[model samples]
Target chain A: MRIICCVKHVPDTNAQIQLAANKKDIAREAISYVMSPYDEFAVEEALRIREKNPGTTVAVITLGPERVDQVLRTGLAMGADEAIHILDPDSSITDPLIVARCLAQVIKSGGYDIVFCGRQAVDNDAFQVGSAIATMLNVAGMTLAGKVEVDANAKKVKVERIVEGGTRQIISGSFPVLITAQKGLNEPRFASLPGIMKAKSKPVTKKNAAELGVDLNTKMIIELLEVPVYQRKKRVIQAGEDGKSAVKQLIELLRTEAKVLE
Target chain B: MNILIVAEVSQGKVKRASLEVLTRAREISAGGEIAVALAGAYSADAEKTLARFGAGKVFYTDHDQVSRQNPEAVFELAKMCAAECKAGLILLGASFLGKEVAARLSAQLGAPLANDCIEIKTAGNGVVVQRPMYAGKVIATVQLGGAQNIVSIRPNSCVAKESPAEAQAKKISLDSVSLKTSVESLEIAPLKRPELTEADIVVSGGRGMKGPENYNVIEALADKLGAAVGASRAAVDAGWRPHSDQVGQTGKVVSPKLYIACGISGAVQHFAGMGSSKCIVAINKDAEAPVFKKCDYGIVGDLFQIVPLLTQELSNSRD
Candidate 1:
């Protein structure tokens, strides 16, 4: 069985986010990049599946500039067989649909039985890519999957997905499905020294839009990327001149500022 | 053009979120009639209650197969109803079920959907939706374009509106289609009286709470104030609390009115979830804890000493 996990390099979630000087996007220069939190679960789950059924291959695919090699290496370290990078060095793209179309083209040509991605990229916060990819390929898709079990022989899989205040277990016809994993689905393993060495030797192929029969040209582009306006920081409203005064001030802030009155 | 509000019924009662949707929908659409599509086996009381929310017409599809949770069937019925009514905008709650239904419906209809929107307003370009990203750390204003724009409102984002529009609550029978998946057997969790997501006040513990046994102080304070219980990533990882109760970048994002953090050093990941709370109270022995920077109020004392006294005070005041 062949599985492909689509991963994206995003700013570390732990980074101190500051608005860019131009206020178009978050300050990315000083921040470190890592695989998306949700995709970590996807990659980890893929590794678990391969472990359960030997002879299964898990390939990690990412689209970004050469700097994203670190992200691909991170996946390789996590036990993926190989990595593929779709280099877009300029980082000009902003639309998720175009990205999904390109990925669908590659997935179709690669003959992957299953494809996985994080539910949404933390940076763009667009959840459309995976669903759009599924639509483009005309296959079953599930998002925010908590638990997944594959029956390779039956071409069916059972998924427990989050729904309104609860979870619903649904089964879908498999062997051409897209799924997005949420965090807490699995713990990603650290790469060992030997595995890290092997990752460097593994195949790290590159595919451009032209090679994938996808037009990289875009009509609508982001005129600007700006950091959203941050609300003013909370002032330390000194409560009455006692230990209990602070508690009263806190309650007032909740009622007046936050408006979460209990 | 009519704004079709999708009514969700659970065990024959209208979910409160639907009313909130109608209220928000009422504010956005320009004098458009609010119609509802009730697509499950529902009681008559539900129909009347839905009509109270300014729904001039309620189109219901009741069938045995769709009485429970069935996304495919719900989508089929919704598609038929939406086409028949010529809905310009489709609204659903951004809950677990709503996300699936909205995703399927948007894909089926080939419409651009904005999911988990905290607010919706008409923009010069189109409808602008403000949705919280990175667990409310960032809010994005989105411009959606399609013949029909589908918007899913986040749970607890909007207040329930009470607009007295005396409209007829008519029930229409609809057909049910076969679903690809069926529930074999289901196990339901007992409902906890207080859920962290909907709690007005939340008192959370972290690694500094010391141990699992020390969590009693946090729980006692929450009980006194009728607040929900929350935990930091450290406490959750140490198995001091269920993961569901963890609040941080990796856990549930909540916007309670008041967030009281005890012994939490306020890692950025932990703050991402609860940073949006209106007022924050940090109780830790360390005066330089990171949580202090984000908190509106701080008590540089042992939480063990502070929490019990606060709980007793609240209990006494309530009595």
Candidate 2:
């Protein structure tokens, strides 16, 4: 079995984001980058599948500027057999269509049985690329998958999708399918010392948009970016004297001022 | 510049978020027709509700494949409707189903999409929208730069208004599109409380709750206040709660009217999901927890003592 996991390099969730002087883009100088959290789950799931199915090959792929090679290395150290890096600095400003197009081009030629990606990228939060890629490739795709079971012999996969209203939908598709990882899928593993050393020598095949024949034109453009203003008027309820008083005061505020309770 | 709004139905009625999208579409129509596309099972009553919300034209389909909510089939039907209507802009609620359909439609139609938009407006012949980035820390103003644009509006961002108007409802038939995916089964967990995202009030617990058994205190408070139960990532990671109940960047983004945090330290990720709540109340023993600074009300006390007392007080008041 050949499994491919798509990963992305994004600013750490805890990074302090500051707008650049132009105010159109985030300042990148002082920010630390990490593999997107959801993608970690994707990689972990792929590794687990490979472990169960002996002789399965797991490969990681990412599309970004040269800095994204660091993320691919992390995937390699996490036990991926190989890595593919689609290097395009201009990708930073492109839309999901272009990104999906490039990934589709690569995956179409990679001969993978299944594809995995983070449910959404944190930077844009578009949550579209995975499904878009599936559409472009004309493959079955499922988003927000919390659990997956593969019957390789039947050439079928079943997934439980996280839906609204605290409900889940069970979906099944054939091989050559795409799945997006949601939280609670699996816990990712950290690289050991030896794994890190081995990853340094792992082959990373680099390509660009021109070579991949992907159009870089974007249909959406950022006009402005700014920090959002908080509209809430925070009125702290003083403890007054003791815990009992604080509870009483809070209840009063909820009933009267907030009017949330009848 | 005809506008098309995809109306979603849950149970038997139209979703509130879809109604909000219809309302927003009416504002951006610029005197053009505001059309609504309804898929799956719907009723005359649902059509009447859409008409009252200013749907000038209603195009509906009850195709067998679409009833399954297959994104491919749904996208095909929506794309065909948009083509027939010559829709210049398509609007949908940024829901799980909506996002999936919009993404595929954008690719098939070669249209640009802006997802999870909070604000959308008409700029001459084009449309501009604002959406949160970096987990709501920054809002980016995006301009749709194509002949046609597809947008998914975030839930709870816009208010739905009733504007009765002369509307026509037409049922359209679409040819079945063979899809690679199929639904094996759907299991909806019996909900005892409101869904976290749609709940008006939410009571969340964090690691300070100690263990899974200790969550009973949080549940007691939630029961008294008639609020949904939520959990911080720390609590979910500790196996005290399910991921579905998690409220944070990695979890579900909620915008309840009142969000009460119990024993939570208010990590940045957690704040990202609930920052849009109308009112925030933080209850923790640590007076200096980051949540205190952001919350509308802060209480420095042991949750074990404070929560039960608050629940009792609320129950007494109700009686």
- Report, to 2 decimal places, the DockQ of model 1: 0.31
The digit string of per-residue lDDT tens for model 2 on B131-173 reads 8887787889999877999999988887899999888988777
Every model: iRMSD: 4.2, 1.8
* Candidate achieving the largest TM-score: 2
Error of 1 at B70 (Å): 4.2
Q: What is the lDDT of residue A98 in candidate 1?
A: 63
Q: Docking category for candidate 2?
A: medium
Candidate 2 predicts chain B with a TM-score of 0.94
For residues A81-111, could you state the per-residue lDDT of candidate 1 as single tens digits?
A: 9888887777655556667767777888888
**What is the lDDT, from 0 to 100, of the residue B45 in candidate 1?**
82
TM-score of 2: 0.95
TM-score of each: 0.87, 0.95
Off by over 4 Å in 1: A20-22, A87-89, A161-174, A210-262, B39-41, B63-67, B70-73, B166-180, B183-186
